[model samples]
Target: MSDTVEGPFFHGTKADLQVGDLLTAGFRSNYRPEIVMNHVYFTALRDGAGLAAELAPGDAAPRVYVVEPTGAFEDDPNVTDRKFPGNPTRSYRSREPLRVVGEVLDWTRLTPEALQGWRDRLAALRAEDRDEIIN
Candidate 1:
């Protein structure tokens, strides 16, 4: 993978955040709460972040925020070459904090049916023990 990526990065979550909030690593994995995350994840694709937001576990509404990495980041190892070749998802992670620069209000939201479909897929993966999260 390349050594650098440019952004206009974004993070998706259900956490309520403000303009100056700093997102950091060492949080629990959204996909697997038993495992703590080592990196703060973000993406260059708005829709990708939106998908993460939708899947994020919470009763609070999903939100996507514009972010700036405070330190070096790299292609997410979980999906970079394992799932698709060469970071087509534009996904990344950082050990350092990511500053919330702004919020993205106009990102596409998934339809209820679409959301259910994704949930079903996740459930199936879990049932089959195929939902391995590399955290």
Candidate 2:
């Protein structure tokens, strides 16, 4: 049987972020939290023709998009405008799921405390599963 493999986790909170959180020089990639941010957004410079096909030909709001918190964002000051340089994906809206934002830490470089926290959650889930089986 295959062993149940847990995973590396993230360590951060809203307190860890700010409205204009800028990435430091040390932050090199979107794969690491210290490298970039967990939350950010980007918009398409031009309306995608694919999305426009669905609508009747007329003047209306363009279907611009923003990337969801797919993973930690890459810090790129060059991507000016509404887009946050931290994430490769663009976010169209302001709100996003916390789970998606948690990918700030690199899987290859997880923090000790973050791993512990993940273990705790996994243990709880396992316990819950056991309780369901016996009851």
Candidate 3:
């Protein structure tokens, strides 16, 4: 059995995420409590589509936050993977079931600029992941 934890866990006030929803999270900085880094996320996907289609009865949706950090985001030790540069986009599964308190916007229906940003962010994340695996 593998002991590896697949994703970072986050705690929030409610579970309000659905697949394809773009979520923004404000991660508090460890160096400065007053500072918060905002990270966007495209909800968990299944077979290249939103995970919502994969849900079955009696199954509670997994609370996963896929980090989409921008170039401006500081590689804060407390908020992201220290091994990765800019801590590029990654999945952050919740440690315990917690409520979410953020906005969940559909990425497919968003304005052009926002959609482009999402695409760019995902591409960057894939590039970073590739580099990490290669090194």
On TM-score, the candidate that comes out on top is 1
Give TM per candidate. 0.90, 0.22, 0.27
Off by over 4 Å in 3: 1-94, 99-109
Per-residue lDDT over 56-78 for candidate 2, one digit per residue giving the tens place of the 0 to 100 score: 12334222222223333432243
Off by over 4 Å in 1: 1-3, 130-135
For each candidate, the alpha-carbon lDDT, in order, equals 0.90, 0.32, 0.35
Higher-scoring candidate on TM-score, 1 or 2: 1
| Candidate 2 regions with alpha-carbon error over 4 angstroms | 1-108
Candidate that beats the other on TM-score, 1 or 3, i.e. the better one: 1
RMSD to truth, every model: 3.2, 20.1, 15.2
RMSD of 1: 3.2
Residue pairs in candidate 1 whose N, alpha carbon or C atoms collide under 3 angstroms:
none
For model 2, state the Cα shift of residue 115 in Å. Answer: 0.3
